[model samples]
Target: MAGPQETESTQITTEAPAKPATPEPKKKAARSRRAKAEATQPAVSKRSRQSPKAAEAPAPATRAPRKTYSEKERAHKLSQIEKTIVGGATIKNAVGQAGISEQTYYQWKKAAAPASESDDLKDLLALEEENKRLKKMLAEHLRKENAELKNKLGLA
Candidate 1:
């Protein structure tokens, strides 16, 4: 039989493993209170309506439009024009060498010519007027389609 001291040691070794300590209840109560507070707060609306005057802010002033051209494009066109004038290159040859369509070259020439006295400038102005007319026609078509859609949806 074991001695008293041996028995005590044996009892300590054979004792069931200690259970994990339970967390304090106060932390859980605090988290639950925070969740309840958030739940009670009002939700924000997604759609907001603005006053008509505020919505209709004046558009920015139109700035003078500048032509966008690459250095290669400018050089090629200038070279072609030089060739045509000095080397007696045909209009077709000049356009081909410039890497642009014949019509485009003519249009550029017309636009660049003197506005006061040149017939080419008069032709260019006529083309510009025609372009305006075409744009107006396209805008009207789109407006009609928009009106039709609005009527169908009962939003007119």
Candidate 2:
């Protein structure tokens, strides 16, 4: 019984794993079909010449050049839009009548603001920087004073 069991286990261990047979046949069949198809079909060049009808078709109409507004034109348009708005027309309607988009109108308005406003902003930014510098200086001075006091009190 022991001899038979050992022989059975050795046979099982020595046997090779069986591979699936269906996939290899399918791949070979596909390759043969593709080979037959390619042989029957004529090869085509990528850049074939256009047909007479396509060549004779008139070229598409060229687009008109885009109109660029100068500063004077932009300011005039912005003012016209504002006047219409002041006369109780909706901003959208005013901007449309002025031949400009609302976003463009806002951009022009922002750009046309008084220089004094920007000057004030610059001054405010300068003051904020000074404040930060002063704060840092004060903090460092306090830290040094604290250390000195600690030394005098024998806490360090």
Candidate 3:
């Protein structure tokens, strides 16, 4: 028979009492395997020494550092390869001209090829143009949408 306001006030005051604080148990220190092994093993004196070479083995010599091509160099190399293709030169000739191995030339050529066996240059150029066009369209659309959003939010 209580009114709505009275019921609400009673519900608000009838929440569970606060929980009692509990004491935290202390943590035990951890012992490492290496520490246990050292403790179990017999100790050696500082005067007991081994030969320097026997104490530590020398590391094997590392291979020479690889050569990295600059962006200009890479572009020039690709251009030469493309020119060789346009000139109808053999892979050997192209490799010679580009100062790269035959394997490297073939690898680059294979990587550059499209799904079809047609000219890769045409495909690459078409892709580049398409990418440029798409980017331009996307930028314009984003600009318009951003302006609209700003106006809606009373930021303009």
Candidate 4:
């Protein structure tokens, strides 16, 4: 009877501590699960909230197509820009007034620079023409020589 009583008392003591420890671990697990659920819920809610706002927002404005300018128009714009500059305005303001970009203004200026040196360009053109004429004359002379050789050999 004593041995049985001791065994029962030990079992009761151990089970009492185990019951308390088990509840603590369960409580901690419940808290962690709640935290995970809370974290996931906010992210899902944020995505859902942003979707409607994105759909309701106006579409981004489309860019305009590029404009093409003729050579005469370009020349007129360049002159206008130059006159504005001569009147003490900056290049930016000058180009803007002429309805052209700074890059276009600079490009037109560079192209016009060569035209100012017409004498050099004219001389270059004349030299090229003379070279072509000489080449034609040389080709004709060679053909005549080839024909003379073929006639002497009686294979013309």
Candidate 5:
């Protein structure tokens, strides 16, 4: 039994008790309310909602060339790649200038490693060259000393 102020919608008559209005949960009520509100407005399709370029077909992805070269040309290209990379340039730019892929450039560098020469062999060769130069210098110094000693000893 509701007061006269209550409308027909809220009136509780003596007739079979009307089902009590189920209280909606806060989250679901808010979401359904929003959906109902949006239903009144016109909706744009996904594609039409995008920029004008959306209608145009995308350009095909470009692939880098896979070119082969003579051994001499390959050497030249490797030098170009190494120079650019060691000079603080990007590997992509260096490889581009060398007309090779980054993979090829690394392959060339790895292959350039001297298989016959170990670290010990390399050190020995360097030391041998240094020893040879020092020996020549020592010979000259000894010759000058010998000449001075002969003159001093009256054997000149």
Candidate 6:
């Protein structure tokens, strides 16, 4: 009696799992149809090319629409994305949370950074140049003062 009940419960659970599994076959069927369509396409195209009257119009390209973001918006999204990544979230999760696709995230990451990063680099370079100039001037002034003092003391 116990063995039959255990088997029955397993059978019920198996049925429940099977329901989800059923959808995969439908997906595979759809993919097979697509494959068949693609497989036949080249043959048809080749034949059409040989026949002057069978010119087929080109298929329209399918692409996701481009979204334009302002500099502030892009910076905000990038910061949020970076925070999520630093918090140990995967890139897929971070981008999903930011409501942007992986493609968009990668595109933004690859392209030039927002103006802030470049501006900081420029400022650092300018400060380095100014520091060099000031150091040279201070050294020259000290050398001149030292010469004058040595002449007064007859040391030079």
Please list the residue runs of candidate 3 whose C-alpha ends up more than 4 Å from where it truly belongs after superposition. 1-66, 109-156
* Models sorted by TM-score, best on top: 6, 5, 4, 2, 3, 1
Please write out the lDDT profile of model 6 over residues 1-156, one tens digit for every residue. Answer: 579889999989989976774455443444587788787665555766777565556544667678789867977898999999999999999999998999999888766464568889999999999999999999999999999999999999
Question: Can you write out model 3's per-residue Cα lDDT over 29-147, one digit (the tens) per residue?
Answer: 78799988778875755543355653475534556667676646755787787788789987678778888777765665565455234667678889999999999999999999999
Clashes of each: 0, 0, 0, 0, 0, 0
Clashes of 3: 0
Clashes of 5: 0
Better TM-score candidate (1, 5): 5
Give the Å error, residue 53, model 6: 54
Better of 2 and 3 by TM-score: 2
After the best TM-score superposition of candidate 5, give how far the Cα of residue 153 lies from its true spot, in angstroms.
Answer: 2.2
- Candidate 3 differs from the real structure by a C-alpha RMSD in angstroms, to one decimal, of 33.8
lDDT of each: 0.71, 0.81, 0.74, 0.83, 0.77, 0.84
What are the per-residue Cα lDDT tens digits for candidate 5 across 73-100? 8778888887888999999998987776
- On lDDT, the leading prediction is 6
Candidate 2 lowest-lDDT run of ten: 19-28
- Give a tens-digit lDDT track for model 2, residues 9-101: 888766734544355644444458778978777564444335666557665566667778998898788878878989999999999998777
**Cα lDDT of model 4 by residue, 1-156, tens digit:** 579889999999988876665444434444587788676663545675579776686655756689898878887888888889999999999998887789989998899778767868899999999999999999999999999999999997
Pairs with backbone N, CA or C atoms under 3 Å apart (clashes), candidate 6: none
- Residues 39-68, candidate 1: write the lDDT tens digits: 776553444225565357564465657655
Candidate 4 lDDT at 15 equals: 88
Could you say which candidate leads in TM-score?
A: 6
What is the TM-score of each predicted model, taking all chains together?
0.27, 0.34, 0.28, 0.38, 0.40, 0.47
Model with the higher TM-score, candidate 3 or 5: 5
